[model samples]
Target chain A: MSRALDTVAAWVLGALWIAPLVYALWAAVHPEAYAARFDLAAPLTFENFARAWAQAPFPRYILNTFVLVTAILAAQLVLCTLAAYGFARFAFPGRDTLFMLVLVQLMIVPEVLIVENYATMARLGLVDTILGIGLPYMASAFGIFLLRQTFKSIPKELDDAARIEGCGALGLLARVYVPLARPTLVAYALVSISHHWNNFLWPLIVTNSPEVRPITVGLAIFGAPESGVSWPLVSAATLISVTPLLLAFLIFQRQFVQSFLHAGIK
Target chain B: MRIRDWATGYLLILPAAAVLAAFTHLPIVRTVRDSLFSRGSAIRPARFVGLDNFEALAADPVFWKVLGNNLAFALGTVPASIALALAMALLVDRKLKGQGVLRLAYFLPTMLPMIAAANLWLFFYTPDIGLLDQILGRFGLPGRNWLGDPATVLPCLMTMTVWKEAGFFMIFYLAALQTQPPELKEAARLEGAGRWVYFRRVLFPMLMPTTMFVLINAVLNAFKLVDHLFVLTKGGPNNASNLLLYYIFEHAFAFNDLPAAAALTAVLLALLAGLAVTQFALLDRRVHYR
Candidate 1:
């Protein structure tokens, strides 16, 4: 009886949790009239999705987000690789203090300092640009932390052995450290991509043009109540906006879960 | 040789360190400094008006209300979500029927952007023709202006937030649980401890460090996540649901009050610093624990 009860409870919680998304799927696929109604016999069409796509510059928004995450990830990997290696291996002065300073970004993120960050961006002539949006996050403290922890775990003999092969500093990192930290790199990349793809407020504050704005900011404008909330259309747009990350997540579900787990445990 | 090594370390970290200095560190210092000065216009130049912004903050009712709402939001969402996440972690950790689908259902919300979640919930909260009202009407219940009413507004946001967050937090507990030795569970079973007893005595105590980490994160999230407000309330019905970050946004953009925004950001900084200390102290203790 107890086992059966537990099963029923788990299923109930899962059902409740998924109900909103299920409703969204229903609303997006059905006609506007069927948005609040449930009917297995309701005529389903893809018109809502077609209309939602044409209604906004979703392709451009998507393209901009893609560029943003790609640039941010590439920069993060390269910068974090060198920095993490420095902290993990070097016996430098103020090492712990510098590491602590880097860790500060983990808690007091860029979102909290929006007014000043916008000012900084404007001074640098990066406002309303994808580079402006990605700049503040490119140094990613979380990436450095994760990579540093991973790098520290590799045995010291490997470093000495690499040095014996006439491997210089960059060569040691490129051949030894980067190759070994591949799982962590993959995990951090996945986490960073999903985060930037879903990010909103900072992008909203920075980008005024649809040309530079990401999908999240575009979706916010599209769904703003003053524009008139058409449930089917908005639902369709929401799905369109999320479908890429959602699909990536569904396909690489285990990796995505593990990436988040890997991130949190550190 | 030591000098070359030290110089190499500095050179290696220069690129990332420089960017972090420009973006994170300098802005933090500037935010506090800017808070001391009032904005300048054509006729009058900008001038330092020390403590004036904070004084104004003290006098402003909206600031206090938003601060209170922020605390309430943290208190409401964090514990509830953590509990649900712990439950979820336990459920998915075990061998269960349709586990794949179950895990997918629980974890899906965490994948979508917060903006998307807000828009989706906005539709559901709409009156009369909304999914919520339609369901209520089936049982002869009246419809509610869910997001419009002051009473239900924060609760509505809280509900959506809890739904959005529980699954994400569950992953942390899941990670913690996965690392535990199987013998712990076996030992509990051998001692004939009931589920609740076993959980409270073993699992919960073992998960203390994770709980602290999640608590800090959840609190930080309450301060940061104001995307839903932009869609759902815009801090409406006399600013019933205005949170601190959203209030800062309103002051900065809507009212173009930079000094006020800086002051608010400073308060947020202090709060984050306090949490950071607490987290460090807790994690410090955990480092020496078994």
Candidate 2:
């Protein structure tokens, strides 16, 4: 009896989780007229997909999002790698103080700093540029913290061995630490991609023109306050915006889950 | 293994340090500076006002209301999502058929972009011809104006937040559970302790550290997260759902009040600092126990 109850409860909860995604897929394929109607006989069509594609510059948005995510990730890799190596390997005056200051950035993020950042960008003449959108996020405290933890987990013997082979600081980092921390680097990349891809508020504030707008801001253009939302088109747009990340997740589902687990462990 | 390595490490870290100092640290300093000045317009130069912005914020009713709304949002979301997440972790941890599929399904939402989920929920809450309304019509019950009505707006936001956040939190609990020594649970069961007794006395105690971490993260996220609001509410229906971040955005951008936005941001920074201090205090106590 207890086992039966558990099974029933599990199925109900599973249904709840799966329902919304299924509903979204359904709405995306079905025509606008059949959206509210849940008839099994309603003919599913790709009209919404075609209309949604033509209605917005989705291809441009996709290209822009990819560029933004890749640019930010590349910048973060260089910054976080050096910072983590420094924290993991060195002793300097005010080292702990500096590290703590960096950690504080984790607590107060770019969103909180958006007001000051906007003015600063205006001063630097980087306003509405992709570089501006990615600037504040390039040095991530979380990435530094994660990589620091991963670096600490490595044994000193590896570093000593590399040094014995005439490896300088940069040489050791490139030849030894980078290769050893491959999993962590990949994990950080996944997390960063998903995060910056979905980021809306900062980009919304910084960029005005479509030239620098990411997909999240692109989706907001379709969202109308005056007219009631057309569910089919919105879902289609959503699917278009999210498809790449979702496809990446599906393709690399195991590695994605492992990365999340690894991030949590760190 | 000695101090020479530290010097090399600091050298390696310089570039990142410079970027962080310029971007993160300098902006904070500037934010504090700007908060004390009055800029009549974007074109006008800022004049020092010495706490005048803060004074104006204290007297402003909307500031208090947005703070209250943010507090209520954090209150509504943190404990409920934590509890739901713990329950989910427990459910998926059970030795059941197709548990992997169930786990994947529960976690699927967390992988999707927040904008996607927000757009999905927006459809769910649409008044007419929405799935929710269609379902309610069958039961002969009145459907709600989920985002439009001031009374229901914040709670509606909370529901979507809970859905998005719970699975992510569940992963932490699941990780903690996997590391727990199973002997205690087995021993408790052998002692004829009921399920609740076993969970409360053995499992829950073991999970306290994870709980504290998740609590702090969830609270922090509750304040920082306002993505859904962009698609769903945008501080609508008489500003009922105006969170501090959204409110700050409005003042700076829409209303063009830079000082007021800076003042509000200072308050947010203080709130965040208090949360961090409290979390460290709790974590310190946990360390002592260990």
Candidate 3:
């Protein structure tokens, strides 16, 4: 009886959890009339998606998001790699204090300092640009921390062997550390991509133009009160905005889950 | 050799360290400094007004209301999501039928952006023309203006937040569960301990470290997760569903009051600092345990 009860409970919860997305799918595929109604006889159409696409520059939003995520990830990998190498291999003065300073970003994140960050961006003349959105997050403490941990775990003999092979510090990092930390790097990239892809508040605050706004900010403006809400159209837009990440997630479901798990465990 | 070693270390760390300091650390100091000055305008420049912004914050009812709502949101979201996550973790920890699909269903919400989740829920919460109302109407229940009404607004937001958070937290518990020794369960079974007893004595204690981590994260999220507000309510119905970060956003951008935003940000910073200390301390314990 208990086992049966558990099965029923789990299934019910799962259904409840996924019901919203399923509703979104339904609304996107069908007309607005059938959005609130469950009608088996309702005709399905791609018109809503067509309307949603036409209503906004979703193509621009997609490109902007893609550029933003790529830029952020690339900057993070390079910056974090060098910093992690320093923290892992070097015995420098103030290393511990500096690392603690880096770790400060882990908690008091960029979101918390929006007022000053906005000012900083304005001072740098980066407001309303994709680089502005990605700049604040390029030096990720989480990335540095994770990479440092990974680098530290590598055997000391490997670094010594690389040195014996006439490997300079940069070359050693490129050959030994980067090659070995591939899984960690991939996991960090996945996390960063999804995060910046979904990031809204900062982008919303910083960018006023659709030219640089990410999909999340674009979706918010698309559904703002000024523009009347059409359930099917809104749902269609939501699906389009999320499809890249959502489809990637669905196809690479195991890798995505494992990446998140690896991130969380660290 | 010593100088070269120092050069290498400094050179490598400089890029990351400089950016972190400029963005994270310096902004904090600058926020504090800026808080003492009023928002400048075309007619007059920003002038030093010590404690004026903070005084305004104290008197501002919206600030208080948003702060209370944030506390309520934390109260509503944290324990509920953690409990659900724990339950989901336990359910999938065992050999269950189609558990992969079950896990996927629960976890999918966590993957979507909060803005998208808000857009989806906005459809469901729309009065009369929404999914919830249609279902309720079928069951002879009245419709609710979920986001429109002040009373139900924050709770509605909390409900959506809990849905987004629970699955993410579950993965952590799932990871923690995997690390537990199977022999402990076998020993408990041999000792004739019931499932509840075994869980209460063994499992719950073992999950304490993860619970602490999740708690800190939940609290931080309570402050940070205001993306939905932009879509759902925009802190409407007289700021009934307003959170601190959203309130800060409103003050900074909407009201164009940078000083007030800085004041509220100062409060947020204090709260985060408290949580950060607690998290780092807990993380230290966790590191030692591992």
True contacts kept of each: 0.78, 0.68, 0.85
Best by TM-score: 1
Candidate 2's displacement at residue B160, Å, is: 0.3
Q: B78-161, model 3: which lDDT tens digit per residue? A: 999999999999988788899999999999998899999999998778898877888899999999998989989988999999
Q: Kindly list the per-residue Cα lDDT of model 3 for residues A1-266, writing each as its tens digit.
A: 99889999999999999999998989889987787778889999999999999989999999999999999999999999999999999988999999998988888989988889998999999999999999999999999999999999999999899899999999999999999999999999999988999999999989999899999999999987569968888889999998999899999988888898888778
TM-score to native of every candidate shown: 0.98, 0.96, 0.98
Accuracy of chain B in candidate 3 (TM-score):
0.95
1 or 3: which has the higher DockQ? 3
DockQ of each: 0.83, 0.67, 0.85
- Candidate 3's docking class is high
TM-score of predicted model 1? 0.98
Pick by lDDT: 1 or 2, better one: 1
Docking class of 2: medium
Minimum summed lDDT over a 10-residue window in model 3 chain A is located at A223-232
Candidate 1, position A238, lDDT: 94
Q: Write candidate 1's Cα lDDT for A134-245 as tens digits.
A: 9999998999999999999999999999999899889999999999999999999999999999999999999999999999999999999899858899999999999999
Predicted candidate 1 versus true structure: per-residue lDDT over B1-290, tens digit per residue:
89989998999998999999999999999999999999878899879999999999999998999899899989999999999999998888888898888888888999889889998898789999887898899999999999899999999999999999999999899888988899998999999999999999999999988888888889889988898888889998798999999988988889999999999999999999998899889888877545
Stretches of candidate 2 exceeding 4 Å from the true structure: A227-229, B1-7, B41-44, B288-290
Query: Which residue segments of model 3 deviate by more than 4 Å?
Result: B284-290
lDDT string for model 2 (B41-106, tens) is: 658877899999999999999888999999999999999999989988998887999988888787
